[model samples]
Target: MSTLSLAGGPVSWGVDFADATGNPPYTEVLDGVASSGLRWVELGPVGYLPRDPGEARAALAARDLAAVGTFVFDDFHRPDAAGRVLDAVDAALDAIVETGGALLVLIDRPGEERAGTAGRATLAPRLPDADWARMIDLLRRSADRATARGVRPVVHPHAGGFIEFEDEVERLLAATERDELGLCLDTGHALYAGGDPAELVRRYGRRVEHLHLKDVAATVRTRELGFWEAIAAGIFCPVGDGLLDLDALRTALDETGYDGFATVEQDRRPGSAGDPAHDLRRSVTRLRAAGLG
Candidate 1:
């Protein structure tokens, strides 16, 4: 009955594609994670794995990895932008079904441009009441579509993105009916935004569809790091080494019976400035000790 699945987002691995974009083949890393005791992985974008679902499924099966979910990003809240967003969601849903993954995560567009100071000071506050309402409407429609396909739609609140704080997250959750939208809580981002991960889980456990298990090493942030830098650094540590309270989080998840993907998401790849594999092992060990695995 333990709801834990050994899943991760390999995009965190920091692989350089050279010219190839999307998901870099993590067969080696997938082997590492599975050996480290993970059971599944939430694959990155489409090409990050094999473009063909059969190939992707075979690759996962070969590595003993279950495809728990995948992510998509488009402006679903804008009426004029509906076509692309809808198409993207449909495509994502098809992939999930094809690969036998159960969840679909929706991330907010990072902003028109990745302007750090200007974004935080200006663009963040400009979202009018109407825009938020529109977002909710889009969420409802998307949720309906996902439900018809039997794939859960999880709204991911991001840090460094426009709706990146506690208030914004709360507003987003409040705006939608619980059945139509669930939270894809990213622990590192929650900590960066000063929200208690355990508290959010406890308050909204019923609406949790998936989780991004990560830690943030605040000391490395250098104080001068911008939003992306913080996002790049502040949110992708191995499990126990950062500021995230995983033990508390586990207790909350256990009590709530959240049987979904608790995916470790470290956007930075291994052998970067730090040892990603070591950090990941430490995280898995910690989660095991806490009875969360």
Candidate 2:
């Protein structure tokens, strides 16, 4: 049997940025995660939780929840922004280490030009060769820092970013050594990018160190909205409530012997209506039913 572990994150509750306006208190988000029956979670945006390691650990422990990883979304393609991006990466690494987490999920912040062309792989602009090299070099440096700190760094190919397409993913994998970098396969983003999540699992195998189990609504393809707008339009739904084939993904994970944390994420606009705990519970129940829990 596969040894995949189930987890959740604050993004399901619309907490995208730590200092974003109108975010719920961190304690409330933790309560919601625990109430939904999740014992593991990802540390959502850097400052969303306590900055002090001890305080952050105590906060999660208080809820009977532990962090599995933290994410850093920055513009890595710009050579000028490399320093700032690494600083953000270091911050995320700090959260991971202090919270007893093992993974640092790296995402390229969505660029304005590509934001509206999220799922239109052919329409999205490709980065110049020089910029692409810069991005890869930045990722490698980030991975080196993460490994030195005893944390694993995984690159997440997110929608509306420079690295969202399968070809880009292929290039990235080709550029980086497997020992220094790994992949975080997100189901909704994979589908949104016109790639099969299960197929990706089978292809990547052990190189996929982490998972984000999300469902993309079928209606999403019909909309002409930007990435954030699509999120507000409910592009991402609870697992099994939309187009994700949970059974196939579970089979792929089993075949690959993937023993990693699969986090349930239903990204929403901040202050969006609907009870986060309720949606998360439904997702957890679906994952259990599909034999992924």
Candidate 3:
């Protein structure tokens, strides 16, 4: 059995992608995290919390919790998106350092609302090969910037993003450096994209610096509904309650001797509400039972 520190984030409660404007306040989410036995949390959607590093630090300190990473969704496919992407990353550095060991999570912003069974059929958005090269360059530069800030840069292959597919993930990983750029293997998205988590671990586990331990509901997964629609329908369920072969994934991580934080992420979007604390606690319990908590 391999043991790694378990963390939880605002996304666990739907206090996510849309940020504070769409969900509960930071303080409340942070409190929920602490109360739920999560020692670390992510600085979800940059502006969702107090922007100032000092203010952010104080808030987390008050709860005795810390920020493990920060998510930055940007239009990397746009030819001119690099500057804005770098700017977002720069803005996050101070707070990231303040939170300690926080990685700059770079996620490609899926431009449109991909919904329904059609959305499920097409997990990828159109990003030209030239644009992908440009994005890769930007990612390399982003890694440089993060290194300068004493933080790490992690590439997140989101389900609705341009890099949702396994081959896309492989290409990105091949272009980046294992020592500099890290991979944030989001289990739910990878599974949703039809990639085997255990195989991914065997292939690129060495570059994995962060993780989002999410489970896709087996029933909803087969429903073939669009990403957001499925998410809105409470499709990302508790660990053991879902279909992921977590034991196999855990064995893969154990083989790698993974020591980084594995934050239990149950994607909860607004209007798709439920008892998040209870769900998160259930995930923690399940992880512990699997010896990965």
Candidate 4:
């Protein structure tokens, strides 16, 4: 197996792409990353790329950054649902292939309001058993398609998204039975949802396809904040500055023998000086020392 390594992503830094000379051009963003001492990057989406792959590849080549994964959303159970879930996945897959990305991250689930109000109105319990089964089946099929095209399907759990709770995570994991259908372990989201990311890593390390290295700020005042609000408020702080225990997470990963890209994630606004490269460099250094990189 390949040794674990560090990689940078564009989402967490809240990059100021608007100010760059090449507005909305991936080359500019990737060039900045290369200058920041990163060898790999998780490109946000192909939509950010130029019309031609030649241009995209040339840009990345200049930075020596490899495309690791792409963020994707889909409804595993409702393939034919009114929503554009499947169509979105198809389009994302096409883009993933174009960018040489091998992983598609799943970050969507049924909305709780759609399920019904059962007190808290969580989506997990509201989902009909049959629909749950269909969703799992859909995921399995999606996994097969991705595998056929040399891409893996990784389920990313979000704090406020449809399947944010721990129970919902368990249900989704139990419903699927394919090696291709894996988990994208997200630290801050798990913490926000009152779930232990390290424990999940220990329990499902074999299924861990990717990772979103996030840290949460838990305080007397912020502990009760909603998930989305926390994200929008720059809830994710630097690795050691937050509530997650990196030592525990590293221990779990070591025990499980898991190997994958561990990308830093923070959603703070970009400073006037420029991109948050200094903060990201600090995070990478700390993560490497902790043995996650």
Candidate 5:
């Protein structure tokens, strides 16, 4: 059976970006993560945590939490922005490595045009051939840099991003060497993009190096809301209370001999009412009951 370590992240507490308005203090988010029984965490956005390696390490250490990785959401399809994106990746890499993190989750940030049509694969515009090639090249370079630093770089196909669908994911995998870039399979995002998580595991197997455990509300799947609007409407629910089949996912992982960190991510907006810790604790309990924690 695969050994899965349960981790948490600041996104559960609505801290997507450092400068995102109304973001709760980092200390509060860490407190909530540790309080909810998670021992590992991803550094949310670069500046959301302290930039200094020592300080970042100290922060996690203070909460009795170890670093699993960090998420870098940037536009990789534009050659003009490649330098800035790479610099962001390096910044994230520096902090993650210093804090004992192994995975660097790379996500193509969603543009306004794609954001509204997220999960509508038929309606979403495809990247032009040159832009697609640029994205693949940047992914290769980013993965190489992360590998050089002894960190595993995993491409995360986010709901509203350029690489959210099965075909895009397959294309990316075909273009990059497996050793250089692995996959961060996010359960909710996979379903939201109209793919089955277990089937993806059966197909990709070991290429999926990391996991993000999230549950999408089935009722929200057919809604016409934008990404952020859907989130605001409670599109992501607690584990076991939504559409994901945790049992099948666990079985698939075991069958494939997959072992790694599976972080529970319940994306929410900052300043939303209700205790985020309560939601996290509920997810941890449900996952444990499902034999995933």
Candidate 6:
């Protein structure tokens, strides 16, 4: 069997309530993940589960499930005097340490402007030079803290966000110490940002610590939709259902000996997981057919 651990996350079942001030509940999403035949799942959008480590652990235990990772979206470019964003990362790491998760996914919080008026990705805002340094320093600090806490920190280059473009990703990789920081290679986002997934993995596989195996539908790209609009328009499709040559990507991973959790994240808007459990099963079956699962 391959060393890669195949899994799925909340967004697959439309469970990401990241924009809401508070998460409504988690039973449906957790159960959905467990029942979808994925032995592992990620703790999506912090605060979706109980903040108390003990409760979170028990919740997963009850489901006979293991956590592969937890997503932490922080705006390093925007921070308050309260140090809340850093504190939130600490909280996420604390949960990961206690809940058997090893990867802490770091994403930039660029939703507000990126999803403005049209609710589409504009890619308008660029961080100032000082802010770029600020973001890198924060990532370094966060990585060091996570290292002390026993989890690896992986940056995700999200669409319509600060690090969406390939050049920006290159800059981030250049600025951060490779040993301390790695990337969550979200395949769909890479394609949406106009980068080839197989090529990217071939070049940067060493810096990859975690994976979100999402396929993309580039039809939305021609529409020039916003980030949220594209997601709502099915920018993320199932494995083997879009533009990605998943088999080729898997072959590349094999050559690189990159064994890690490959969580299928077919991102959808909240409450938009129409027949998603079936879609997830089919997706997994597709990956298995391609020697992925």
lDDT of 5: 0.90
- Per-structure clash totals for the candidates: 7, 0, 1, 2, 0, 4
In candidate 4, where is summed lDDT lowest over 10 consecutive residues? 114-123
Model 6 worst lDDT run, 10 consecutive residues: 114-123
Q: On a 0 to 100 scale, what is the lDDT of residue 133 in model 4?
A: 70
Worst 10 residues of 2 by lDDT: 220-229
- Pairs of colliding residues, candidate 1: 6-39, 12-266, 12-267, 12-268, 13-269, 14-269, 23-48
How would you encode candidate 2's per-residue C-alpha lDDT over 46-142 as one tens digit per residue?
9999899899999999989988989998898778999999999889988898889989998997878788899888789889999898899999999
Better of 3 and 4 by TM-score: 3
RMSD of 6: 2.8
What TM-score, over all chains together, does every model reach? 0.86, 0.98, 0.92, 0.82, 0.97, 0.90
Candidate 4 regions exceeding 4 Å error are 15-28, 74-83, 109-126, 220-223, 268-275
The candidate, 3 or 6, that scores higher on TM-score is 3
Q: Give the Cα error of residue 87 in candidate 3, in Å.
A: 1.4
Q: What are the lDDT scores of the predictions, listed in order?
A: 0.71, 0.89, 0.79, 0.66, 0.90, 0.77
Model 1, stretches more than 4 Å misplaced?
15-23, 76-80, 112-126, 220-224, 231-235, 269-271
lDDT of 6 by residue, 96-138 (tens): 8878889998887555755432212234666789878887888
The parts of candidate 5 lying over 4 Å away from their true place are: none
What is the total number of backbone clashes in candidate 1? 7
- For model 6, the superposed segments whose C-alpha errors exceed 4 Å read 18-24, 79-82, 113-124
Whose TM-score is greatest here?
Answer: 2
Arrange candidates, best lDDT first: 5, 2, 3, 6, 1, 4
What TM-score does candidate 3 reach?
0.92
Q: Residues 220-289, candidate 5: write the lDDT tens digits.
A: 9889878888888888888888889989998999899888999998988998766888999999999898
